[model samples]
Target: MPLSFYGLLEASLLMLNGIAVLNRERFLKKVFSFSSLSHIKFQLIFTRFFSVPLIAINILVILFKLLVG
Candidate 1:
């Protein structure tokens, strides 16, 4: 497998997770909720905030490897 392939996979997973995180209210109402975790909101916020840079970094690294290696 190539770096680009891995990058695509990572980006896809990130997009799925982003969808899940965005629709968390529906998930909680229709599915399940972690009531024990008081910081669930904060965790979701952190995930939404950090995932973009993580995806960007993954793409940049993959491009660098594909171009330079």
Candidate 2:
């Protein structure tokens, strides 16, 4: 895979992070068909935990690729 694809994936994850952090209600209402607000919030919180680490890992990968190249 190329660095560009990683960049795009990082961008996507950042966008998801923004949506999860900034516009919880609006995004959740339109995107997920959850029966309860609590459930949606829980999912958001859960996703938040993973997304941060993913972003960090992506940054590390990008750096590693640059170094290797």
Candidate 3:
């Protein structure tokens, strides 16, 4: 089995960012503050969480391929 260079880099950055967010006090506060908002806020929160990373990954992959190939 072969490992992709971009996949490894993406996974590593994601993990590192996830860990950093979890440990940061301001981030934790914002994450918890979402619960106090209305249902619309909750929906927006989840949508952003899933969509932002996906868009980021797509951009990173395109840039990586452009640079490498």
lDDT of 3 at 17: 57
Tell me the tens digit of each residue's lDDT in model 3 across 1-69. Answer: 268985688677777557444643556556655444564575556566766776687688779879987
Ranking, TM-score, top scorer first = 2, 1, 3
- Highest lDDT: which candidate? 2
- Evaluate model 2: give its TM-score: 0.44
Distance from true location, Cα of 35 in model 1, Å: 9.7
Q: Output the lDDT of residue 8, model 1.
A: 88
Q: How much lDDT does each candidate structure score?
A: 0.67, 0.73, 0.64
Better of 1 and 3 by TM-score: 1
Clashing pairs in 2: none
TM-score of each: 0.43, 0.44, 0.36
Q: Write the per-residue lDDT of candidate 2 for residues 1-69, one digit (tens) a residue.
A: 567986797678767657657665666667767679777677867786877787787688679879977
RMSD in order of candidates: 5.3, 4.4, 8.7
